[model samples]
Target: MDKSVELLKLGSKIRELRMAKGLSQAKLGAIVFKDQQSIHKVETGEFNPTYIYLLEICEGLDITISELLDFKK
Candidate 1:
């Protein structure tokens, strides 16, 4: 797969996990030290999250980074 597609997959996985946890983008952003707009950009695949940001989001979601990448729907 292409890198951009991988980013989109990652973003979709993150959005799924966040919604499953009943979190708003703003709330998830607080955990990742970002703003809701940033989170929205990520979910829409408009931005690629930094490694640190991805780590923080996984931690905040109480999921492992590998789990976040496991886009099994």
Candidate 2:
């Protein structure tokens, strides 16, 4: 798949997990030491997160990197 498509899928997966955990963008961002706008950009696939940011997001979501990238569902 294209890189953009991959980003979109990753964003969707993050959104799904965030929703499942009852987290708002602001809350998630706070946990990740970012802003609501950053979270928004992330979830919309408008920003390419750095590896550290991705690690922070996974940690904030209480999930592993493998879980975050698991698109089989």
- Per-candidate TM equals 0.88, 0.95
**Model 2 pairs whose backbones collide:** none
The local lDDT score (0 to 100) that residue 63 gets in candidate 1 is 92
In terms of lDDT, the poorest run of 10 residues in model 2 is 1-10
User: Candidate 2's residue-wise lDDT over 1-73, tens digit each?
Assistant: 5988888888999999999999999999999899999998888889889888999999999999999988997
| Cα lDDT computed for each candidate against the true fold | 0.89, 0.92
Sequence-dependent TM-score of model 2: 0.95
Worst 10 residues of 1 by lDDT: 1-10
Model 1 lDDT tens row, 13-71? 98999999999999999987889999998988889888888899999899998898777
Give stretches of model 2 more than 4 Å off. none
